[model samples]
Target: MVCLRERMKMGKRSEWVAFCFLCFSLSLQTIQGYKESETARTLKLEQGDAHEVHCSRERSKAAWKIIEEYLMPFVEEERYQISRRCRLHSDNDLYRDQEQHKIHVGVNEWQCGYCRKRFYGENYLDQHFDNRHYDLLNVSHSRCLADICGALHCDLVMDSVPRKTKCNPAAAAKNQHLCESLADTCFPVNGGPSAGRLHEFFLRQFCDAHTCTGGRKPFSRGHRKTRSIFYLFASILTLMLLALFYIFIYMHRRGMKGGTVELKRISKSVQKKKPS
Candidate 1:
């Protein structure tokens, strides 16, 4: 009986040891996997930056097809086609004339695809689209698109795809998992690309590449102007306060002198009036 009890205790001890070893191995594997993923993401970012620089250098001379080929792997197919079209329309006068004839009745008019509304200009169309069609168009896909592009270290191409009647069920189902995986591998927990970040990135790139009317300025000119105005107003206010302070001091001194003079005059009168 005593020998059997001792063997059972030994068996339990061995099982506990095995469990701990298994847990330790899993933790080590997880750590290594995380490190490898981080390294890969860093490499991808470096490569993307190099690609962007090359694109910028060749942007003036390179054909749309060549640019598309270079960017195709990094962006979605729909986005690539839209970007290609936009480039062609902007660069080729013939293409622009043809598109304008087909799409615009006037020099500064465009039709909205969703509501068939006529807008006076491209900016108006853009604003209308954002206000009226943004939710109906993007829905759930925007988040997935942003996360995927972020993970791939690519720019998010906007206004590329048409509005969908319904959200993509498959994409919706997998979006959470994809976001989590991307966060773990490509971005920090707080730094992952959301819809706003993707929009910001697109706007920055657009401003850098094109010269659209009223587009965002590269140097934060508005912010600088605001700061300058604030400083000017503050300086004026300080000067005004200093002037008021000096006037108050001058008036107080004058009042004191007047009071002293009046006292001297009264004393002189009293002395003259006294019997001498």
Candidate 2:
């Protein structure tokens, strides 16, 4: 009976141990799942760089807004080397022999190629500096320069090899001519009235003030006056035609007496052709 009692206690202890282990494992799995889920959500938000990026989770909204409003502004004042790396299943997932391990998520680690300073998060490395170090920026320099290209400079080439030395002089001259002609002919009150006036007006309005000056009286105004005069002559001709049209309508309304009077001012054959 004592042996039986000892066996019962051992069995109960074993069952209790098993239950505790199971609960511990389940809790660990839940925590790990949460971590992976959060990471994926963060990645999804980061991928939306084509549009304004925002965190997917509502809990992260406050943090993201704070970063944008506060952190982003401050970052501009400081020198930084920010880079984006894709967090993949593995660093060398392609080379992984184990199929089960191959399909795992991997956190991308960033390091300054120059300084070899490592960072876990992209934001942390963004404000990387070289106060104590010398020439620790060869790797980050390429990315830093890339971000500044076109956005910060009037002339920026994405390609490693530039396509042209400079703009073709003949092509530039042609564009200049077309631009000037459009400015002269299409602008209201200054030149030949063109159908493209509205488009030109909007273009001038929206064009960058630095690149395209507005409200400045063009040097070609004098030359454009010639075309304006032609427009004026055309307007006069139209007015004359309209005046004759009104007169003809009035004369018809005034009946045969007006027609007879008009015929007397004309030849016999033309007079006969007049309306009775």
Candidate 3:
């Protein structure tokens, strides 16, 4: 019985030893994993800047064609201010002539799309348009067509299809993702002409305003300030016209009143006097 008891105690001790060994192995594995993770993190940090990759790529012609096909429609309608954000408003515009007016271009001459009037190089066409074709540019709102198409930032998703992509603001997750992707892709700090200067210019000009940078509004605060001034001017002009109308009416009524008093005095004199 004593031997049986000793054997049972030995068995219990062996089981306890096994449990302790198993727990020690688990703890050692956990510690090793934590140390490995720290080492990996330190190596990553030592590798230098995370976004040090300068953009050396240029978009293909097929990509540009896709962009043109998808975006040109919304750009034409009511946004002559399409320059720089959507694209530059220059001689290179695909459908520049079709804007409210038809533009005619010659070897060294630039003609007004609205009136066919001619101008010299660099066009100054926008100023001419704003001054003369003012009616076409004016709208209830000056928001970007991205407010409709949502393609301004999603040029990659836009280029996914060979021909064109539908301009749906609801393209979500995919639509909004490009803004951050483009900061690196479009024009990184290290980006230069070899990375594509024209391409860089295009991306910088177009994406800067459309991306999350510009409060996501195409029209800057300057547009708002100018719009407010325009409204103020219009209000003042309207008030002036109304005031002039009231003054004219008052003058006419006063003249009639004066004439009526004089007539009454003449009639009273005649009545008091003889037939002569």
Candidate 4:
């Protein structure tokens, strides 16, 4: 009996130890997985900047075809085709011919697939599609035709992708997790000489390439004083002018009332004297 009891106790202890080990191992695996996912989420993004990555589509016919194919599903297919074809015309022709043609075809509202808001004209619709639907940065505009797509900061691309380092140290320090570099990425559409400068100008305006260092300008001291003085002088001048006008009106009315009262009193006195 004693030997059997000791064996049972040992068995229970072994089982408890095995259970504790399994729990620890599972916990460690879960923790590791979580860290990896978190790292991936912030991997390319700089710290202080909005999360953005800049990817370029290789400048080839194949690339544009692929982008158009992917973009078709998220966009109204016929509308996109019209816009793409219109891009071939010179600016002058686009303004003169394309505008008239689009109007003749009927100015119709197109609803956004994501937001479901309708836009009035083709110009507004084109702007809406670019700003709302294909607004993501890291993924190729082609890749973003699908509903779930990554948004990369244009600033990140401006600072990191082309240079492969933070051009602005302050912005990088603030948003360390937000920047990623894509090497030798060429923007096919922008291969023209003017395209590079234009893109850089746009990137500076909208990208997270730098930190916002200065506050908005306050009202100037001279302007504030001038405004206050003008207000005070105007108020005093208005009161003085109002007082003069009021006095004139009161005097005019009082004189009229007095004259009428005097005339009635004199006529009554004269009649009373004669009738007696």
Candidate 5:
């Protein structure tokens, strides 16, 4: 009866152990499944982020291509038309005769009121006003005008009165003078006005605020010097990297050679001992 009771107790202990093992196995499987699910969720999120970035990059590329292919030519053509119109009006005999008669009649010869300097025409006077009195004009103006005229120095004009009709030749010439003056200020002649320089100036001045930086800093000798210095530093860094790589290769080859010599010496010594 004692032995039978002992056997029954052993059987109970074995059953309990099996139950505990089964529970532990189930817990481990549950923890592993949770980890796998979390990992998959994280990977999916990363993939979504990567896809978004790729789409953004593709859109940017497409936009740049459109600007380069279509928008640039259109801008160039508009600039050409502006420049041609300015040239034609500037050379007009009727306008020149009118200005000459004004000067002959002692009508002040289109003089700048601020500087008291005389100009041959209204265009030159407008240019002087833009170059010299731009700051004063801005402070004097009570309100800002809408950018409908597409002139850079139009901002300097104190008139906030809206126009009901399209600007005539005289008004257009005045706007052109303003544009040219602002262009000169923004893009000073490094030598002289080469082809397309004026166009670039106009584009910079009249471009959308969101697209352009407003010609804040003109390209100058200082920028060129800075670029040269940067290139010099980059070249020096590349040469230093090459030197380090060469040194690493040399050291690795020397280490291999030394190991080969040591092995050869050991093998020879073993052979000698065996023959003796």
Candidate 6:
């Protein structure tokens, strides 16, 4: 009977030991799993940060190249490197626009804006840019310098994305002055009344972009909207002017066509003799 009781005690102690071992094993596994999850989260965050940095570098790389190679050589001011208003028209001497212009499409035909070459609909125009102007840009990093291309510069090529329009006037004054001066000096006043109007338009465009009017940035919505409004206004003004011109012509011709009554005048001596 004593041996039987001893066996029962041994069995109970063994069972208790097994239960404690199982609990310890489970707790260790839980700790390891939690640590692994935390490490995985840390790694993911590091990767995301690295990816963002890489993307930013890639985005600005092409813009830096443009600044150094194309713009900086003749620029008088170091600060104007990133400016949209300055040095835009001056860059034309270097064929800058032709190097980076967009493709134009017409009915059943595609034309390369850069080269002025025509292509059939069987091929894509995007492919043409890749082949011709690929060195001018990085297709993967698109929003390189949308806000900084001034005077219709990169209007079609880089204007695909809208730049943040909230310009700071105080910070932007120097560049604005550059643009205004370029307009006043470059465009000829003696050319005609049309030339005067063109100068005024450029002056307004360059300076007005620097101001925030009524707490709202001027949404040019790209050059397309600006050009459309200009054309519409000009068309309406032309029609009105033509109507007025025709009305004046019609009035002059009608007066000329009107019949006139004529009576013969008699001399004083003849009148005296005849009447008497």
Best by TM-score: 6
Model 1 — TM-score against the truth?
0.23
Kindly give the stretch of ten consecutive residues in candidate 4 with the minimal lDDT sum. Answer: 216-225
TM-score of each: 0.23, 0.24, 0.27, 0.25, 0.28, 0.30
CA lDDT of every candidate: 0.46, 0.40, 0.49, 0.41, 0.47, 0.51
Query: Which pairs of residues have clashing backbones in candidate 5?
Result: none
1-276 in candidate 5: lDDT tens per residue? Answer: 999999999999999999999999999999999999999999989855542211122222233333334233444544433332232122211112222322221444665555567777665664554455544432231122122223522222223674445436565555556656644443445524443464464444343221132333211111111245558989999999999999999999999999999999999999999966
What root-mean-square deviation over C-alphas does model 3 reach? 22.8
Candidate 4 error regions (>4 Å): 43-108, 111-118, 121-128, 131-276
Candidate achieving the largest lDDT: 6
* TM-score sort, best first: 6, 5, 3, 4, 2, 1
Per residue, candidate 2 scores C-alpha lDDT tens digits across 1-276 of: 999999999999999999999999999999999999999999978654323222122222222322233223323333322223311112212111211211112255556544467767543443343222222222321222222112111132123464545435564344345444433333333333332443254234222111322333222111111245558989999999999999998878789877877777787767778877
Q: lDDT at 176 for candidate 4?
A: 25
Error of 2 at 252 (Å): 24
Better of 1 and 4 by TM-score: 4
Model 3 Cα lDDT, one tens digit per residue, 15-125: 999999999999999999999999999887865443232211122222333345433333333232332432322333322333436343654667775577877742366
State how far residue 228 of model 6 sits from its true place (Å): 32
TM-score, model 2 to reference: 0.24
lDDT tens readout by residue for model 6, 143-201: 33323443223332335686756556665565566556666655445646654665555
C-alpha RMSD of each candidate structure in angstroms: 24.6, 24.7, 22.8, 20.1, 33.7, 17.8
Residue pairs with clashing backbones, model 6: none
Backbone Cα, N, C clashes tallied per candidate:
0, 0, 1, 16, 0, 0
lDDT: which is higher, 3 or 5?
Answer: 3
